[model samples]
Target: MNRQAQAAVMFLLGAALLHAGATDLYLRYVKAGLQPLLLASGAVLIAAALATAWYERKRTRAAKAASASASASGTGAGHTHPEPRISWLLLLPLLSLILIAPPALGSYSALRAGTALQKPYALGTLPAGDPVPLSVVDYASRAAYGQGRSLHGRSVRVTGFLALDRTGTPYLVRMALNCCAADAQPVKIALAGKLPPVLQPDAWLEVTGTYSPKATHDPVNGGPIPYLSVTSAKPVPTPHDPYDETWNN
Candidate 1:
């Protein structure tokens, strides 16, 4: 590839990265904490692109001046620079990012093996609120390791996509990210009652339910997981930030 083409590609890549980081698009794939790094890298790439252009322009001008002087003296021979083919693969990622704009990890991603639930922090008094909002990761932690004792009488709310186990048992599931989607782990809760007829896999919903600490088998990992006795549920639009990060209070 010629220097110009390489420089252009770099610029495009940087711009795409900057755009993703500056906007909410990045949150879908990784934690929001990466924004600053993304932006800095993008700026560096753009600066490098500009430097490449300037250096190429100066070299071109110098070559032109030398050729003109030699031609005037009728003593110069033609000089040629080899051009190499640029692989089409170079454009694939940029095009994909611009056109498709891939979504974050979802149900299919959650189904992958080797993923496990994230460990929760030390327990504290339940946060204030009736049917308080609780993350799937938090609920799972309190349910299994806490012996379901901490959540015995408290009603909590959780939001996640609808899914079904092999036995067709309905449940709520969410993938929490430790870094990016590559390390995302799925946290699930079995819904204790019938769900609305229209519910489908990947359909986002918020449910208000009580935690049942009764010992139960975890279909995903074959260990104990928390269960929710769902009292009420409703469809909700997919949240802009889909991941539950450890740093959140």
Candidate 2:
């Protein structure tokens, strides 16, 4: 290929890698840890493409000089050489993308949503016996803040997968993360009333309940035990975009 063609091929390949890397970073890290690396890689690739173009231009100039000298000497300049082709270089980025497509975050990570994390205090008193629409993320965040302490033992409703524990009860429920599973926290809630008729892991449900603070008693460490209490449990459907229960973006 001529200098222009070679430069074009390299530029395209670099651009492809940059795009693939960026997509993977976003999907896997959710704009958390992978963003800096993605940006740096993109900058490097652009610089490399520019450098390649400059080098190709110099090579073309030298080739032209040789051709002109041969013609001036009345030599057989009719002997034509096929241009070099570097189109294969474009495959580099394509191969990288195929090899490293980040896997979707799945059910495995949802189990780790709330353990060891301090539940949130309620911002204010919850309405008693009144149905309130709530997001799983909001619920989880509030629980983390203080388990709705401000709600003053009022009932609240939350929807998510019925992550049943080994005891066959809806004790430790969870939601999956699309990217990082390691950070998943199990949402622990005390089932106040009777257990659901069909308790199954990964089954979706909405639970309505009153907030009750359980006394803390920690055996593993000297620190005080975390309060664990809630009431009025009811089942509901899994929300749309189940993977991202938080809906915070």
Candidate 3:
């Protein structure tokens, strides 16, 4: 690409990153911890773009001065090749990010993806609360191994998008991202008891429930799917950050 186009692309990309950070939109694509990095990187890109523009201006002026001092056409600045049209397509994502950022991974991607279960860990004790809030990753992990002893009898609340497999079995699902959406995987919990009549896919839900010892098999993998014996379930607006960030760590 020409220097002008190169600088423009850099500026647009930087602006897009800044826009994501400024609006907390980065949470949709990456882990929460990357917020500062996103902001800083955006600033760096913009600075580089400005510097490139400045240098290009200076070079152009010097070339013009040299040409003015020359009497022959051969002494003038050489012609610059036009940048490839395909290169401009790079701005599509940047413009989308700045103008209409993508929504977080939802039921469509979650249900399509196979379960991503991390090795079980000792969660020890439940936190203090009437309905203790828990991440979907934690609940799913515990339920995956050691019979979920930590979650037994505890009134735990978890949030996730609602989804149903081909069998119409409802699950409370959340995507777990390693770094970004390209590596996103779904952590699903089979929800049981006291379900609403109308459970729409991609609808966000906060469910208060106790862990059930019995589990179901995944339709795709046939692996043990964790169960949550729910006490209450209510639709809630989607959160700023939708990925279950705890699992990757």
Every model: Cα RMSD to truth: 2.4, 7.8, 2.1
Give per-residue CA lDDT, model 3, range 83-115, as digits (tens): 788887887777777778678888888777778
Those runs of model 1 whose alpha carbons end farther than 4 Å from true positions after fitting are: 73-78, 247-249
- Total backbone collisions for each predicted model: 0, 33, 0
| Alpha-carbon TM-score of each model against the true structure | 0.89, 0.47, 0.91
**Tens-digit lDDT track for model 2 on 36-144?**
6666766676777788889878887997898899889987655567764565566666566546654443334434333433434334444556556554545544554
> Can you write out model 1's per-residue Cα lDDT over 1-249, one digit (the tens) per residue?
677888899899889889888898888667878879989998999999999988988998998998889889997668677765556478998888767766666666565432366455676678877888888877877887776777878889889887765677676878777778677777777788646867687889999988775546665567555678888899999898887785234
By lDDT, is 1 or 3 better?
3
**Candidate 1, position 209, lDDT:** 87
C-alpha lDDT values of all predictions: 0.76, 0.51, 0.84
User: lDDT-based ranking, best first?
Assistant: 3, 1, 2
* Of candidates 3 and 1, the better by TM-score: 3
